[model samples]
Target: MNIMSPPPRKLGRIHVPAVTLAHGGGGKAMKDLIDDVFVSAFATDTPRALEDQARFDLAALAAHGDRLAFTTDSFVVDPLFFPGGDIGKLAVFGTVNDLAVGGAKPLYLSCAVVIEEGLKIEELRRVAQSMAAAARRAGVTIVTGDTKVVQRGACDKLFITTTGVGVIPAGVELAIGGIRPGDGILVNGLLGDHGAAILAARGDLALETEIESDCAPLHGLIDAVLKAAPATRTIRDATRGGIATVLNEMAEASGVAIEIDEAATPLREEVRGFCEILGLDPLYLANEGKIVLAVPPAEIQAALAAMRAHPLGACAMLVGHAHAGEQGRVTIQTAFGGKRIVDMLVGEQLPRIC
Candidate 1:
């Protein structure tokens, strides 16, 4: 008898309309599912050998920069799909922003997904394609990944985890520890868009608006800031806990104080209205595309100019400043000429938001 081999490429549409337990059994069904959905969608200039891991040339990566940056994040946003973006796009850009804010040029990512058994295969393909598009836009590649389908109710409709690696240019320095008194605080765009969008999408509040997630890749904007302000102290993406939580963390980490003008904090009317209606403070909301930067006073204008010149930073504002005072303290000058401490959130404000 003669032995035959599998096809060199498994490029075809998914046969089954929905996932099943067999898909997670690591059998022929699993291979077909992976090939049809993830492999095909993630195709790139790189070879698709479907190896256990991806390999890169050290010399090739070293050409871009000397230091390497690595970060990982998991996405389990409710509704899976929402206005302005979906979980797939969020997973990719979220990790990219992590590496970017660290002053790194994002390069590659690993996408691992867990799908509920009843999920539609088309939905899975849609998410994979979206992730691929986001990676391309961010100038990065999804080089490897894993997939698993759990029993019905074992997992949500889907959950995605992305791990990214980037390279930081030589002569670049940034960290919370670098924060100093009199450093200017700036945000790239409107805050609470993501948090508000998700809240409204869930339909729990019986409220409606046109607010959309501010999800985006920030590496381009970050590069612009670095070029204009090389002495920038630190850059942090305001995610789960929003800008207020980020400021508190920075103050605590650096043993300094952060003071922001509540009047100067930029916000969209829709977001502000949404928060007001729900008694939610926009400061404590999550933001996907915004960053909090601490820049030396002398370089503040340069950094702001560079940011505003970018599409993502068009609404950028000088919201706050670091100062000398009680360690780990954050004070906001209210619009009514009063001051209040902007403390970290005591409990989960909006859970399952990216």
Candidate 2:
């Protein structure tokens, strides 16, 4: 069997010290930047012609499944680089997870970057290479992209928007409405690591911890889950709004009540203490590598076993279960033996957490 090597590091150099308006002028400067930075980093078996759009062979894509899953997301994390990942890795996996939750085999991604004039050229190169490495790990391609350099004051140092396309296998159906009373709520790993890690990275709180963002690609984990529990009702990546917001959405969509035990929710001691110090709720905190799944009771054990067997889902656990109660209501049994409503956050708890 042939094995694939990792993507090469730091493909090319940026002659300029900082990005300037000329880089976005669509002239020679822009072409050179594209060639040296993006092309070199994302090179594949097939040569890229630097075309306006990426072309895909119909037959090659059709082989994966019958339906296509498409999703797009934007990243503007305050710190471009974080403990476990950077903006580029977040952009790639963010869209990949969006497609994966829909039971799609993530295949391709489109990256568009908006860079502020005067931004360091090295920063741009680093982000591109991070994106390439992430794509290779996720088994997806960054096929086409656009770059725009705006005046320094017009935007942050850098921002990225990624669009992903994937194929959904035939006969696999997952929908929010499929959730019913008695279904089990499962999570792939400890919650709120990304949110806590980013908060600490900001340094405003003067707090310190060893927690790292759980940013990762989940296609392999999701595949293992489905193979074990084909009757899963829904799967969602807990991103910006965290598990609380995602659960609220699922509960509302399915018109079912969700009740979870706080003790059953897996959390790291570091994250637990961080949330306590900041008066933050882990449920409202963001996570890049965590997933909230609704599976039938009979298949819950099987799903848990499969998730534990996978690297990404090693921390998987049964967090809660669905039941008949007030429609669209979510309640949590507190550690103090009291129950309270776990509603959607009224406002942003931590901005740019994704």
Candidate 3:
């Protein structure tokens, strides 16, 4: 007589309305929470086994590139939900963008969440579903994750940490040190939208304006730039410190002076107004879906064209150029026919921004 193996175990389910200490007790309750919230949301072809790790085909990964790019970031933005994106979406794109800026093709992500006790189960489910949707949009997979519940007040309502892995294609190498004098500086789109949106979402200022966060995955836009201008020098995402920070970093790293035309910098009217009223510089404000890059003057046009061709880069513009001067100095040519130094931020203008 032939013998048969036992069937695979089914994923557990949650019955509680809100998370509790029992869910983090490493028993049936914990398993149920993971299965119902994360597994169900990030479900894919792989078997939902209670394995300690996720696996991938080595050969398949090798096909995309010669080197691996790995990055991790934690999101603790105030207001779990916000205009244009939420903490979950920010977590996914934030990690994905980190890999993309390094010339990597983002592939997989590992999501870990710390949920405070008493958070509604529905809220947790919503975040998980958001992450799944963002991963799909970025053409990546949520391969593995962990969940934890902390006592009330021990943590925020929710915090998400996503670790990403991508493959950097062969023949592609980018670094800030590659920047040279006369290289043209470029940015993908309007600045400070994310910062302004977050401020408005907080309701602390009692200021109101229609500005949405510019959170987005940028691998596609970066790939287009590379294909169009093979000689592009480097790219850096303008995140917490925004484009001003990125430019200062590139200048310091490459030992070059950089100057930008304030008139050329793109800004949504709402964001510009928001910054003016709050006495904040748009250049120093945070952005989630913007990039600062240097392209050889010879290929600037091509790079600009490629960037403008993509939806994310529709407002791409050449804002500055590196030149020989006081090394690591960055200045902006004011729209009013004056110039001033653009220095690194002393402290965060907006705390808990992302």
Candidate 1 lDDT, 76-149, residue by residue in tens: 99988888899999999999999999899999999999999999988888998999899889999999988888
Candidate lDDT scores, in order, read: 0.91, 0.91, 0.93
* Estimated TM-score for each candidate: 0.96, 0.95, 0.96
lDDT of 2 by residue, 1-354 (tens): 986855544433458888989999988888888878788889886443456999999999899999999999999997999889999999999999999999999999999999999988888889999999999999999999899999979988999999999999997899977799999999999999999989888877665456789999998999999999999999999988889999999999999999999999999999999889888999988999999999999999999999999999888999899999999999999999999999998889998776
Clashes of each: 0, 0, 0
- Candidates sorted by lDDT, best first: 3, 1, 2
> How many Å off is the CA of 270 in candidate 1?
0.8
Q: Write the per-residue lDDT of candidate 3 for residues 92-124, one digit (tens) a residue.
A: 999999999999999999999999999999998
Q: Model 3: runs farther than 4 Å from truth?
A: 1-8, 206-208
